[model samples]
Target chain A: MNEIRIFSPATVANVSCGFDVMGFCLDSVGDEMVIRKVERKGIHITRIEGFDLPYEAEKNVSGVSALAMYDAIDVDFGFEIEIYKKIKPGSGIGSSAASAVGSVFGMNELLGRPFNKTQLTEFAIKGEALASKCEHADNLAPAMFGGFALVKSVSPLVILEIPSPEDLYATIIHPQIEIKTAESRALLPKEVALQDATTQWANFGSLIHGLHTGDFEVIKNALHDVIVEPHRSKLIPYFNEVTKAAINAGALGSGISGSGPSIFSLSKGIENAINVKDAIEKVYAKTGIDFDIHVSKINSKGIKIIN
Target chain B: MNEIRIFSPATVANVSCGFDVMGFCLDSVGDEMVIRKVERKGIHITRIEGFDLPYEAEKNVSGVSALAMYDAIDVDFGFEIEIYKKIKPGSGIGSSAASAVGSVFGMNELLGRPFNKTQLTEFAIKGEALASKCEHADNLAPAMFGGFALVKSVSPLVILEIPSPEDLYATIIHPQIEIKTAESRALLPKEVALQDATTQWANFGSLIHGLHTGDFEVIKNALHDVIVEPHRSKLIPYFNEVTKAAINAGALGSGISGSGPSIFSLSKGIENAINVKDAIEKVYAKTGIDFDIHVSKINSKGIKIIN
Candidate 1:
């Protein structure tokens, strides 16, 4: 039955120091999955277009999470699933989160919308868990609710809305490189000094205040992360020089986009955003790295289907 | 030269996880210091009413900070200083901060208000260093600016004003037994796990959201301190039972107020606040502890001269 067809958007997680609990929906950059009920009483999965993708059901992250949802809810139904992977697979954005959220969002519509955002978020979290062993909803909430969002607590996944500055623009530069999430995470320290942690909290507290008050300078200062960024930054070839140049070129702040390889710089306007993108691209050019630069507004709306 | 006389309030530093970077004005409970320009060559000191407090000029925390401004600016001026201690000594609620802020606030006024809140806070922090051996300004901002506040970054002392819930009521219970702030601080760990730090950031991030959005429940869940309160809670007698009782009796959240010996439970209204306060007081009574309970609204205005 096509009555259950639904679409979900893509999201970004760890919006600066909010590791597992903070994320937001961007109007641009996302994926869409459509689920349909069938009388076959079995799950069937097939890639709609891309030949660079997997074909196995059990191995496919989306199929696994969707199957898990059906099994958990004990829903006796078969489904046909199609994924429009608008967001590039390894963009350091929420690629799988978009899939998980899409399947759950579409499946719920197919299943009479039995769950609310929190409940759906719970199911989507399971989807994330199936992929990462840990359920990080920073990417999910923004995908689900559309606009800047946060998960207050991960245990219950208390997602809250974060204030977004209107004049802000983001420039994302993805230098084609392969650094698996596992390897990236492994490079991070398992423990940090208490003083550094306090600094993180202080920055985080101020970041929220800046967002709420629409003060960009506070946001700029609060974007400093002494815990993860410093250690993981070494992986990227010219992270220091590029970031420094970006800031010098009038970008408000810059950081490793998501889990790295890609870099993002936030700016106050279009000119500053373009300068940030150009600055980041210049570093990749010096390293003989091929990259794609996207200068866009903070996508307030997360995921939407083009078709 | 009778310049305008003004009194600055005492503040509570280290709101559990927000160490050295968070404080709020106590409109009612704080010390008062008056500054009036006099025909003299140097600053003079006077300790006014309130429990016959010590008036050690050379080593006085406020006196030292106020004196630093004169040395730095090289403006030799004469002024009469008076300290009317309102908040008790060794109380976790910024006893030292009151005098520091008072002196700085008064000195700024005496100096034609050349120093803004940040500068005054800096001077106040210098005063804090003389007493606590640490330079911090959390208490000074709230003492100077009033309402719920965030100190943000310490080096530059970036102060921010967080929106407090409209009906926020603070029920402070001070047990007669004294607990030194240094001892309470000493009980904390030097290092914290990555997972725990992530959780703390989630809580901290949520706290800002709670304060900004006025979500009492979010604030309640976000008020926990994994880094400090867990370790420090053991030192306070009946801390466990008091917190349990307060939460059970409709308190949004409860914790060791400031450095403790004094415990505070936050509630949305008078009835719930009183209920939580009485419940905790009842628990304290079981241990035969003599405690004074103060049930009042969060004083948005810190310290004001009555006469």
Candidate 2:
């Protein structure tokens, strides 16, 4: 009860039509973290492997989120954290979110689950803000609650967990390049055309309906981003080609995963997802870009206890 | 079947967050029309009653939609329409849509139902455009398909019929004022702040989810119009007071019914709807506006066969 190990999932935010509001978790891509309660009265980061990130407890994402959760609780004992970061930071697949959610989720479990998912998401976004320079729950909610999550509102913190289809799979390609979330977000216009906004909401509503009804054709037709992708895609090399390749290879839909450098496509099954991954890989290979491709089932469980 | 008699329900469109895409049909507010097949090869409006309207088939809302549908099919006989209109034009409770849907729905039945609902909507919106000066399916889809409907897209014509909660009811108050749909639409800004747009889509997506799950609290919270109501409410006298009265009297949500002079509020049951109606009537009565209030259950069947 004093110690916990958990798998915190990588997630794809922005999901085309649902920019800034929707996301889905990945089962095969994540980071593992171990948290142990200590007698000391402060949070500590004992170890971090596989990625060179800030180790200072005050500066780290996991530490910042854990501290937020810690300050709100009356726990006498402190927590020691060790992270095995597999999802690379700035790859646009919610690496910071995985770490952010990991700390809060693990800490909550060790404290006998004092906080609900929404509260955990609230704490996690404080950490997420450190990385994105914005407090958004799109990635944090899905990584903490799993399946497809829609951050309905951040102020009151309403998060709806949309049902993921049984056979839904994702193919993600993380190009070995960094596109800072803050910089990519800065490229977006402060205002959008009302007509374009209308189209975006229509598509977003349709996509949610499609997910609920498990209609692939509706999903494909509705998964389009008219607001953010056009500007952000310019930051990532060969974004259009990769998306085309994914769709042509049978993905239900494809788009820039988050603030880009990573692109994701959703398909109906693992086989189709593999095909999409291969198609994307072929395109990325020709671009002479080093990349990592992952084919994964949509994670139904967000953060899992790993004994 | 050489002739058909039908009741075409009026609709409330742009339901708060779902501006331009969402609507619901009403049981008590509608128009009744009778259509007969004739040897002549054209559409004709044979009789006019209850409300003064254009008798010419080319100019009348019903006749215009009937012609659109009539020309598309290779029907052997022309159609004669007798209209008993109950909904008032420029009232903004989709009077044009009821008429438009009435013709197409009655024609489809008289011809042994040749066209599907989507095709019928296509014809109906042609007539709606004549009144509103824009082609929108929010009202038409609900009028044709009944209950709650989302016009996911207008061009490709994807309509999603959302299930209404069993106990849902509507209260509508028409203040006997005129607000042209075209003029109201012209009042909207060409562009909107990205933050407002994001909030709008969030509420929209949440509203859809709330409807699907039948969660009243979620519906109440999500039933906000940040994008349109602020500007359009100015045209409707005592708009704020009426809305506040409805909410205070236990209506789930209230907003301008279509491009309003008519204000609509949805409540959980008939009793609440009546209470809301009384409350709205009280507010409008003090303003010296001649108003008509109607309380009815949600219409599950759109264009019903009367005889």
Candidate 3:
């Protein structure tokens, strides 16, 4: 094939108690990219649409991820790429990961799929590195594999796909505000109280158990973030009010999505997801934050070829 | 209904990555208790067998647990108990939990079962408080509920029973050495590096995913302890050697069972569990530590009435 179009789903990283480790793909919001094989011996970005991101190939996340993949397989193919950035940058919902994951995902297909999911993940994390000065797969893995994922180890790159309950729905509220991922991360403590860490991991363990067993009660009880949320929630306006509204609206659990400005809640079904969105909007509407609400089931089929 | 006999299985708490939160039960090693309802109006330990545990009603773990249950129910009936200590105390396993669980379990049967598992767990944790300085259900929950458990919160008493893979087996090596639980716990840092805590919880998340999905490779990859084990492993003799031997013998993972004299390894089946035992014995036999090895399937039944 001369060209392929791929859509990479937006993802919520650090899903509450599982900071820097857990993430899930979302169906409603995503980024689209088109890669076409060209006679030129070098990669080029033909056009960048929808956002005012850098056009320099070396600086863009997609370009960096493609370069990583090219280095990994030593491929001789050159491609022209067009990025349709639908997932807004600095959205705290893995906008960069979509570009990173989409680039490598498309590159693997264009190079006859030499790399596996894990290998592709390794190259894709470079996109995060370019964006945040650190390589983390919490976002990239879910964007590539779909569903819930646990990045067990980053060095050897062990990412496990956790089972998502079939009845689960995701409700995300992006308040049209920017919280830079790097700055949000910098807000976290360099050290944590041992007791708080224990509690956090305990919640993390329960969350994974709940996801696998489809026990909504366990998930509800375990959706606590003692480590990151306390530090990052202050950056988002009305975080506590919005989260409480989602929970009161029958969300199984709710917390800041990624670094926030976007808060998400997991519900048992679509109707409850809409309810949670409406409730959070009520809280945000009073603040006049110009928000967008997304209600969708978890995107379990991550980045996919459109045509 | 005059007398009852109950056995509570021993447990491996902390389970590498889940310090103070996760634990699983063992079938082969346990404690046995016999409770007889008497005409008196208070709880009493009439006979203590097999070990020189404190006979004082408030001092003993079993006594404390029984008293806690009595206080909760405000029972008027008195009970006399006999204890047979099989699980060694200060061996890093849930020896005290077995006693606490067995006493409450036997007492509940004697009283026509007034409380459920969670209620029983609450009373049982009082035994831990009596034994140590604080109330923790990491050991008691698994012993009472069976299989793997995550103590999501100790304050609200949230304990979730995690599903266990049927093929999983546990191999434990109690090397006739005692590491006082208090001292071992004291060895832990009051605070931990944020990066290490994140890695530990990430592993905890993956481990739960592996257990729920029955993915052995994910379990193997996630069987890491970056928090407590690094600090406590130094207290155990041949900790590194025994762990390596178990891994070489095809054990999926191995680590300090709780807070150090006992080390446990998990394997896929009975054969591998026994193989792990043999390998560990080869290392410990040279040390002349008078070790005892128990290889058993993951005990799904926690406290059972033997009648």
Best-fitting candidate, scored by DockQ: 3
lDDT of 3 at B145: 90
Q: In candidate 3, which residue ranges exceed 4 Å CA deviation?
A: A74-76, B74-76
Per residue, candidate 3 scores C-alpha lDDT tens digits across A207-242 of: 898888888898888899998899999999899999
lDDT of 1 by residue, B190-283 (tens): 9999888888888887888888889888888887777778888787888888889988999887777667777777789889988988888788
Error of 1 at A68 (Å): 3.2
A1-307: candidate 2 lDDT, tens digit per residue:
8889999999999899899999999999999999999999888999999999888878999999999999999978899999999999888899999999999999998888889999999999899989878788899999999999999988878999898689999999999997765688789989999999999998998888889888898899989999999999999999999999898999999998988888999999899999999999999999888999999999999889996
Error of 3 at B41 (Å): 2.7
Candidate 3's docking class is: high
Q: Put down candidate 2 lDDT per residue, B198-294, tens digits, no spaces.
A: 8999888888888888888888888899989999999999999999999999999999888898889989988999999889888988998899999
Leading candidate by TM-score: 2
Here the TM-score of candidate 3's chain B is 0.97
CA RMSD of each candidate after superposition = 2.3, 1.1, 1.8
Interface RMSD of every candidate?
1.3, 0.7, 0.7
- Worst lDDT run of 10 residues, candidate 2 chain B, spans B177-186
How displaced is residue B58 in candidate 3, in Å?
Answer: 2.3
**Candidates' TM-scores?**
0.94, 0.98, 0.96
